[model samples]
Target: MDPADSHTDEIALSAEEFDAVRAALARVTSTGGGAQAHSLLAQWSALVDEVEEGYSWCAPELDNDLSCRNALAKVWPLLPSRVRAIRQPELDCIDVRYRRATIPWPDRPEEGARWWTWRVPRRLDVEAAERRDPDWPLGWEMMPFPRPASVEVVTWQYVPIRPSTKRM
Candidate 1:
């Protein structure tokens, strides 16, 4: 992960992955596992804390979508086999479902809207998507899924973008 990405807002973990990390920590701590296990457990515990504080509780921007993926790539290989085997499919499932929800319409982008609206369908059930992956910085609709397609539509509103005050 980039050192600059350490901003609290840039960390994310899916609900299932967070739960798996907690469960693995509990098992390892209770078993009094050795040095390597303790090290891994500690790292995972910190990650859990970061995710809970950074993404779960805080309201993060939806436009940038790689925070969770970048964070996970660094830590995933270190996770225990059982946790890895169990969580991969669950995460993949969510990715698949969310991807389906985001297919675009075949027509050109709507007037006064960014390209995101083209990828994410109109009138998406935001609440249901949030329920599916509450850990996402924004709802699942904000995720940058691969290969958008043409899908149906619903109600949509176009809001004007404002300039940011913060200096880069």
Candidate 2:
């Protein structure tokens, strides 16, 4: 287990916990009055339990397609607005591995659209690595998981929206 890995895991876990807390808060506020706070708390706890059970096997299946995306989506709403905006709204599941590759935007070539790429780093386990590799390698101090990386965002280049003129 590398220290970097531990840190990454910590960050990811913290984010997950934060989201849970936020959801509880939102649920409480949705009721719009103090009378329902207690009931909402009970429901919130149950919801948390359900979420935990739902993701119990998430770590092991991080390499799988749907599972990985589901995990990502769990954290998606918690992400900063700008980051969330970068992703397509309709995308339900995203493969972490596939997201690491460069994605091409061929639909808007006229406006000089190019490829977009991003990499989400993997979380590391520091303690496990120490037992396996006595001497930690350079760059191992960094988080094992890839951080969100992105290419230049194409603000606007939609051909469909462009006006076409024909001789009258």
Candidate 3:
């Protein structure tokens, strides 16, 4: 048998395997899992870069590449609970309560203590109600127009996504 032909017999990963590797790497990378996880991710990234750039693979390099990917897959599941708990922030609509009242700060009555606070959604339609046209006098007024005495500006909150029920 030709020595060079042996290379062809080495296992090449299928597309599904590649996808699994990528998904695990992406999750660990996004969380900044830890020094060890970062190191393993870096190794996997380097392997991907080389593969993409058409680097010639020696037997040892191919073995190392496969090993690195497998190690990363294993490490991802074993990350510290706190690190695993980390997640990307998501946009969430919140309820804001504000009232027309004297400003608490001096010389800023117009900008006054209008003292506004936000709370989790009392219901999903809060955003729609806050954004709709004024109902007080039954007409829409453009900006710089007086807002009702007590009005809430529907806004968003940046919060870490929950593990379950991913959507708001």
Per-model C-alpha lDDT, please?
Answer: 0.39, 0.31, 0.35
- State in Å the error of residue 54, model 3: 0.3
Error of 1 at 67 (Å): 2.0
Which scores greater on lDDT, model 1 or model 2?
A: 1
Q: What is the lDDT of residue 66 in candidate 3?
A: 51
- lDDT string for model 1 (34-142, tens) is 2232244234344333332322221233224433343344445656565555455544443343344444445655333243334443223232223433232234444
TM-score of each candidate structure, all chains considered together: 0.30, 0.19, 0.28
Candidate 3 lDDT tens digits, 1-168: 532222321234556644554565556555443334445544555554444333243324444445655654455565443333231010000001111111122223433221111111111112332345543222223222354443333333446676886678
Task: Give me the candidate number with maximum lDDT.
Answer: 1
RMSD of each: 17.0, 21.9, 24.2
Superposition error at 117 for model 2 (Å) = 12
Tens digit of lDDT per residue, candidate 2, span 10-67?
1232565445545543543443223222233234333333332332222223233233
Using lDDT as the yardstick, the better of models 1 and 3 is 1
**Regions of candidate 2 where Cα sits further than 4 Å from its true position:** 1-67, 78-100, 108-168
Deviation from native of the Cα of residue 12 in model 3, angstroms: 37
